[model samples]
Target: MAAVDTTLRRTLIEYGQTTLAVVVLLVGWEVLCNVLSVPKWLLPAPSQIAADTWEIRAVLPMHFGATLAAVVGGFVLAIVTGIPIAVLVVYSPFLRRVIFPFLLTLQSVPKVALAPLLLLWIGYGLHSNMIVAATVAFFPIVINTATGLESVDKELLELTRSLDASTARVFWCVRLPWALPYIFSSLKVAITLAVIGAVVAEFVGSDKGLGYLILTSSGAMKTSVMFGVLLLLSLLGIASFYAVAWAERRLCPWYLPTNTDPPAI
Candidate 1:
């Protein structure tokens, strides 16, 4: 009970600090906008963004839902595809030699540049958005998981081999568990990339989602609406990141965030 109370107090304090910082920033921004007589087209104030948010509340949800769906689909696809392939790269010399160079080449090519190809093949839809988002999030998961799998202590593996442990036992008991931190770290990064990927895909080809709305707002010079969309996008990224982080905590209770409390999740 005492520990719970302490945790509650700390949470309140942290939230208070965050709220204060946001308030100060908004107040300063509102003042600067007025003092400079900033054109609404150039920079809408926080109040203007809030007003725009309220005005578009109905449509915002639909756009937000679409974007969220794409991010989720892409993020899940990356995880399912990436981790197994990474394991293959770690375990198979032949596959490592063949696949790694191709992966690097693919990564080097800009995803936005592939927008036209995606549109040509997938044709401006949710699948295209998922592909784009998956492309953006794929590399980190591969790299991190591969590193973790390869970085297992050599001595430990030798001991397991000496014990005549089965290959699956060695992997489950030693390799995969040890790689959880790396996997989760990549997931956190991947979630953010997924959001960006969805937006980028929407920017070029789609008529729905936050990216499309932001593009539309820009064309109309509705800076306030753009700001609102930006805020919504940022919020989406933050929420997704924390959700991954929460999973990390559950999967890896031994690991703790640097300079912070263990996440409740």
Candidate 2:
């Protein structure tokens, strides 16, 4: 109970520090803009951005829903496809040799560069955006999951094998649990990348989404609206990342990240 209390206290302190830092930064920004008489079109104050965002609250729901759907769909697709590919890579040396190079090549190609091609092939719509997002988010999940599965303790493997455990049994009983941390870590990364990919796709070809809103706002020199959209994007990314982290804690209660708590005396 004491350990739990200490961990809770540390977590609260960390959040407090982060909140205080953000508040300080915003305060400084507001003061600087006011004192300098900064042009709103060039660099709007945080207050201006907030007001602009509030003004667009009605339209925001539509754009927000579009982006959210694409993000969630793409993220789910990446997870669905990435994990099976990782399993195949782990279990089949031939497939690993054939697939890894291809995957690396795909990863190396910038998603922004690939967005146009996806737009052309998939047409300018939600499907294309989802594909782009999946492509952007796919590599991390595959790599991290493969690494985790292959990283099981050799001694544990030997013990399991000596017990006449089948491959399926070994994987289910030993490897999967061991790999949960890595899988969840990849998920957190992939979710953010998914958001980026969706926005990039929207930038390339869409008439909708926050990315479209940003592009139009910039062309109109509505810097406040652009900043507001950006702030929304950041919130979306942060929220999704934390959602994954919360799931990780629920699913892998035994897993504790390093340095999250002070050393016990």
Say which candidate scores most in TM-score.
1
RMSD of each: 3.0, 3.0
Judging by lDDT against the true structure, name the best candidate. 2
Question: Each candidate: what lDDT?
Answer: 0.92, 0.94
Q: TM-scores of all models?
A: 0.92, 0.90
Q: Which residue pairs show backbone clashes in model 1?
A: none
Q: What's the distance in Å from true for residue 18, model 2?
A: 4.5
Q: List the residue pairs that clash in candidate 2.
A: none
Q: Taking the tens digit of each residue's C-alpha lDDT, what string does model 2 give over 25-66?
A: 999999999999999999999999999889989999899989
What TM-score does model 1 achieve against the real structure? 0.92
